[model samples]
Target: MKQKIVIKVNIHCQKCRSKAMEIAAVADGVISVAIEGKEQDQVVVIGDGVDSACLVKRLRKKVGYAYLVTVEEVKPKEEKKEEKKEEKKGEKPTCQPQCHGYPYFVHYETVDEPNPSICSIM
Candidate 1:
């Protein structure tokens, strides 16, 4: 079955982005890789039978710090729109426990070299 895997990687430059894409491209089942979100921190991968844990490990080793955000089965556009409509009608969107059952991970890193209080989230 096809799945959409969204991962958060610590990308700081064009080189980092290129490395991230390269690592993801050579992954076992990655059909495509793209950067998403306003901050361009989310890497979206679409493929069949993609292993989330292995992909995260590869990214961490080759790209930088990486974390699994979510792994979800791909859905048709009409089904996705229906789910969105249900969300708008007060239904909570169901979350699949793909990140080892964790809701989310908070990655803390220093924003500036001299200041500890200046922090960023990934």
Candidate 2:
């Protein structure tokens, strides 16, 4: 079951808020964690089978005083995708690949072998 838990945490600064968010994120079955509320002191955690009480306790111990604002079941939203038309064999597809985050690497260099030898370990 998918659940959304909103915890009101006493976040005084950026560090406290980040710590609270980090704590909630590392919890078991957590899908997403976001700092919310008007004062940016609430931590919103969405996940499957998340322990709300334990999460608040961890925040209280690590960050500051914390309490459960709300715990409720959330329904997943379904998006409608447009169907693509049949393309000619020579034509390129319209869709383009997108990179979400920083690329860990640009390209890998392939080392050409000058000679091949049988393994002697066997």
Candidate 3:
């Protein structure tokens, strides 16, 4: 499982910070290591299947005292649905859909004169 592990280490100088970052980056299954927090003593490690306890122990050994601040599973962002309602220009429909079949259809152009001899029943 992918996880984001944050560890707090007592960093004194720039060299210690670099050492801590290097040690965290070298840990197995670590994808990326970054220094964070206000004082820059927190090392954030993001990866899959990274053992938080093992990393803290390794940091304690090399870069002095270290402790795990948080170990949380990283969930992927949900993708948005992109629905396209584009109309085809070359394949335009000849006629629109009718509410009923030909039995209920009326053609206006069939009218010749205002007074016609045709019956309305037809």
User: What tens digits encode model 1's per-residue C-alpha lDDT throughout 65-116?
Assistant: 8999999998755555445423256745543333445567798986666655
Candidate 3 lDDT over residue span 47-91, tens digit each: 987778877887888889899999999996773566433576895
C-alpha RMSD of each candidate structure in angstroms: 18.7, 13.6, 25.4
Backbone clash tally for model 2?
0
> Model 3 misses residue 89 by how many Å?
48
Q: Pick the candidate with the highest TM-score.
A: 2
TM-scores for all candidates: the values are: 0.61, 0.63, 0.62
lDDT of 2 at 121: 92
lDDT of 2 by residue, 43-116 (tens): 99999988888888888889889999999999867734654334568854433222234568778799978896
Sort every candidate by TM-score, greatest first.
Answer: 2, 3, 1
RMSD of 2: 13.6
Off by over 4 Å in 1: 76-122
Look at candidate 1 and give me any clashing residue pairs: none
Clash pairs, candidate 3, are none
